[model samples]
Each structure stands twice: as structure tokens, then as C-alpha cells.
Target: MNSTRRDFTELTMMSKEKWNDEELFYFQHALSQLLQYVNPEGLSILHEINREMHSRD
Candidate 1:
């Protein structure tokens, strides 16, 4: 058997999409820059995950 978990940050982003457009937009823009500063690979993975999540909606 295998188990998987979502990180706290991922969960937070998922919930943020429920907010109004401007709020969500700012949240995303901030996260994008922060992710780049933290790690380029992290930003790549984050963008990929974001695409998958949004595609489902």
C-alpha cells in the first residue's frame, strides 16, 4: 500500500482559489516570485501542480 499527503502550502493555495479574484491573483503573484527565490525547481513544480489543479476546475 501507498500513502500520499499534500503539503500545508499546497492546501493553502487550493483554498485561496475560493477567494475573490483580486485576492487570489495577488496571492498567486506573490507565491510565484517567492517560489523563484526559494528554488527554481520548486517554482517549476509549483507551476505544473497549479496547471493540473486549475485544469480540473
Candidate 2:
């Protein structure tokens, strides 16, 4: 897997309490970007994040 996807996965696993609005925005941005590069397994993870992001709205 690419480092971009790896880092993004690690980021998602981390606690969100430290994430302010800007950080959270970047996390969402990273998820979108990673979706272009991920495999089937990674796609599932990103999709889950996408769902959570949408649900937050």
C-alpha cells in the first residue's frame, strides 16, 4: 500500500479529540484523495469514513 493510504489509515485510527476543525477538514480531504489510490480493502475503509463524514452533517 502507498504511504499516503497508510498514513491516512493511521490517522483515522487515532483519537479525534485532538482534531480541531482544520485538522478534521484535512482528514476528510485525505480520505477523498486516498479513495483514488486504494485497493478494494482500502476502499471499504475510506467509504466508512465517507459515511461518517456525511453523517456528521
Candidate 3:
């Protein structure tokens, strides 16, 4: 597999562990940035769109 795909799988597995509060925060932050890059702005836009959709209901 490509390095990005491999790294993402590893991140998914690693994040499932019971990390300390600080470690979990850092891991989530890194994962979010990685996903943002992978989606080329889609992630942020989707989040904003989802917020608006939910607010409208």
C-alpha cells in the first residue's frame, strides 16, 4: 500500500487504544490534520456544512 494509506491504517489502530487524556488530545489533533490534508479541504467544508444542516432542523 502507499505510505499515506498505511499510515492512516496505523493511526486508526493506534487511536483505539486507551490513551491518557493528553496523549489522546495530541493524537486526535494529528489525525484531524492528516485527514484534512487527505481530503483537500473537504473535511472542513463538510464539518461546516453539517453544522448548518443540523442547525436548520
Q: Which candidate comes out best when scored by TM-score?
A: 2
Model 2 misplacement above 4 A: 1-24
Model 1's lDDT to the true fold? 0.54
Candidate 1 residue spans exceeding 4 A from truth: 1-37
- Lowest-lDDT window of 10 residues in candidate 3? 1-10
Q: Rank the candidates by TM-score, best first.
A: 2, 1, 3
How badly does each model clash, as a count of residue pairs? Answer: 0, 0, 0
Of 2 and 3, the candidate ranking higher by lDDT? 2
lDDT of model 2 at position 23: 50
TM-score of every candidate relative to the true structure: 0.38, 0.46, 0.33
Q: lDDT score, residue 5, model 3?
A: 34
Span of 10 residues, lowest total lDDT, candidate 2:
1-10
Query: Scored by CA lDDT, what does every candidate get?
Result: 0.54, 0.58, 0.45
Per-residue lDDT of model 2, residues 1-57, tens digit only? 223333455666765543344555666676578777778866665566556556567
